[model samples]
Target: MLQSFMNVFTTLGDTVVVPIVIFIVALCLRVKARTALMSGLLVGVGLTGFGWIINAFTPVVTKIVRQMVSTTGINLPVVDTGWQTSALVSFHSTVGITFFIVGLILEIVLFLIGYTKVFFATNLWMNWGFMIWGTLAYFVTKNFWLSLGLSIFMMLYVLLTAEVQADRYSSYYKINNGTVGAAHNMENVVPAIILDPLWNLLHFDRVHLTPDALKEKLGILGEPTFIGGVLGIIIGILGNIRRLGTLDAWGQILGFGVKLAAVMTIFPLVAHLFGQAFKPLTDEITERYSKGDTKGLSEEENIKSKKRWFLAVDDGLGYGEPATIISGTILIPIVILLAFILPGNKTLPVVDLVSIPFMVESIIAVTHGNILKTIANAIVWFSLGLYMCSYIAPIYTHAVAQYGVALPAGAVLIASFNVMCRPLNGLIFLAWISGNPLWIGLTIIVYAAFQVFLRTRRQQIWMYLKKMSDRNIAPTSNSNMASEIKKQMIKS
Candidate 1:
């Protein structure tokens, strides 16, 4: 009886079932069937496109790098095809780290100086180091030390360049007023859109005064080390004054640590238990099938046996009903409640939890009009979902690893769960999902420097969109609510 029920539940969660559920939900929400179908089709096409792009670009980058190595005698290692080229991959090195730090500091300094003009400039630098470094690193070297060193150099170059630009005056701002801007914004579409059109864009007049300006403004501060120390001391002093230097913070920290441990330790154990409990169901069928006990059962029994096999496997995942409810209803509510009761006025954790899913849903909800737009947004959402998985899954896996729990062979696990999800989410959001090659790609290289220094998603998104809009990169769409409804009705 238990085996039969487990089988039924497993069947309900299949690949086919999930899409059906998505379709049903979309329909119930008044998302037209055609719109949903198109969106689904687009997701498939985008994934296919992604694969082809990777297959094509990997070789091209490899060929170019090899030639460059041959000519320049850089002695860089050959590219490793095995490593993923996600934002997280880019962030895991010394250079990537340094680049982000410098960009972040510069952003704060510029903000202090009331220089909102630097937002685009900063994003470009940070994005370059992070966005380009990862994909380029794969082609350049395999050694961790070499990669780290090079990444740092790249970050340094970007920082110095920003320093130069910050001190200089602009003759003209990049004009992103309409559809023309949208084409330029498309990553690598034309490759040479003259992002700045000579005199107006170059700030040649400002170049002469940049050194003098840098000296007058930032030279007094001197080296980065001094600035870091000053900031640390300020934080330390504030901590001491507030009496939040130790035990007060420790409890929350420890509680999160415990929660992480539960995810890491408890989840897999439950999975294992479910597996063992259902083993008999599998073994009996396997035994009968292998031994050819055909006379014992009818055609319906045979169908039931296959169905049982599917269910037994699915139900053993252990994250079925309990985890779903915990995540969707209970866990989220508890997190919010805790945020309310446990301390600070800042809803950092709650906001982070809410933001990522919210962003994904919002993007999808907005794209419910056109076919390609809907599909593109869905692919983006899927990509975002993977990022969320990367974020939370690691925390649980790391917790287990820290406690020295040995996982089953071939089981992928996370190393640490960042309970402070908002900042981390913002980092992942900017560096990975938002600027994915499919979304913005190398344009990010132009925009990333602006992004690395900021800590908040709200601020980061605001800065990023403003930069795009100011530069006339974000294309303006002309759809309103009534039009959207009419379009949906036409599609259905």
Candidate 2:
């Protein structure tokens, strides 16, 4: 019966599952039936379109990566297939369905307890994060029940961390009440949180550099599309120069330039569609849940009285931003270069190159569109990421092999940024290697401490947001300005 249910869920995919869940939630919140249905359908359509764009781009990126690998003759012991491969290994495992069900129940429970305001239903497909943990735990303990238990604990850990950052995420995205934040890629959260304070300590957070600034300084070349095109051309020239003549290399460069520009061009349109889908739902949530009689309430009370809930959405929503894509594009050659030069680094970041946006999104948010800061933060993050990927490769290879996934020739291991970048994974790998339960205890304690620290720093975070907005030289959209004004009013 469970297997049948899992098959049905998998068949429906995110397009169906996300819409159905959103529709149900809207109805339960007393949203009008027509509005609910329309909102749900819009989300489905938007997500479907977004997924199509991603699918279209993946092969283009993969081809470039393969070319780079071949031309460079850089052989590593592990193949980096990125998160997509990991997702496949995860969902195909024997316990995939069971893990999904357990994760869903845990999300619901967390929501009911007010431990999380973001619903996980909208991103049910991202349960691959849970699957990664479960698979790893099973490999370690050889006990299914214990593995399931550990996976549940990890789910709770990530959701709680996400909840702490959701307010800032919503503010940064200027989504207002329209959408909630989710740590869809849990791997990015731990590193981001750990590194955020260091970014501030270095005063990089105060350095304001945006794409618009680049445009003013460099003219047309600074435009995101142009920059993307240039970066693509550089990468193309580098990758193909070894294999093709100068003329052909330039042609390859231009071709790559156009493809990347296309990707940059299409993303924002998809994001706008997603925003449109969420509007009705946002209106309904605000109207139904906002506190009544707010004239004399204190600022804190006023904010508290307003609805705290948001429609949880995927981290893919972050990719639509130009800065993210620009940063990711710039990082591709840098990452490849690092793979070749960075001693002790075994994994080339080919497959995960496209995922740089997801990894860098949180840093982008915290830095408030400072591309320089974002890039700086990304360098630190991915440096750690390279090491983490290397550390987890053997364990990941073993777990996947158990599911009949074969490693490539001369490849004794496998790893991806999306799977191994998490501090949770690092701790687990340490625990596994040392055969000590102390590492697990230490990880839990550190996570718990971080949450408490975040909860206490809420006011400071709001102040930081205010300061960042004030420093922003780019003109704010009316919606963003209004959101800022509303936040200010509440604080006052």
Highest lDDT scorer: 2
Write one digit per residue (lDDT tens) for candidate 2, span 252-340: 67888898888887887887777777777776666677643443555344335424655677666778678778877777777778778
Q: List the residue pairs that clash in candidate 2.
A: none
State each model's C-alpha RMSD to the native.
29.6, 5.7
Q: What is the C-alpha local distance difference test score of each model?
A: 0.31, 0.70
At residue 278, give the lDDT of candidate 1. 28
Clashes of each: 27, 0
TM-score of candidate 2 versus the correct structure, residues matched by position: 0.87
Q: Candidate 1 — which residues are off by over 4 angstroms? A: 1-25, 76-468, 471-492
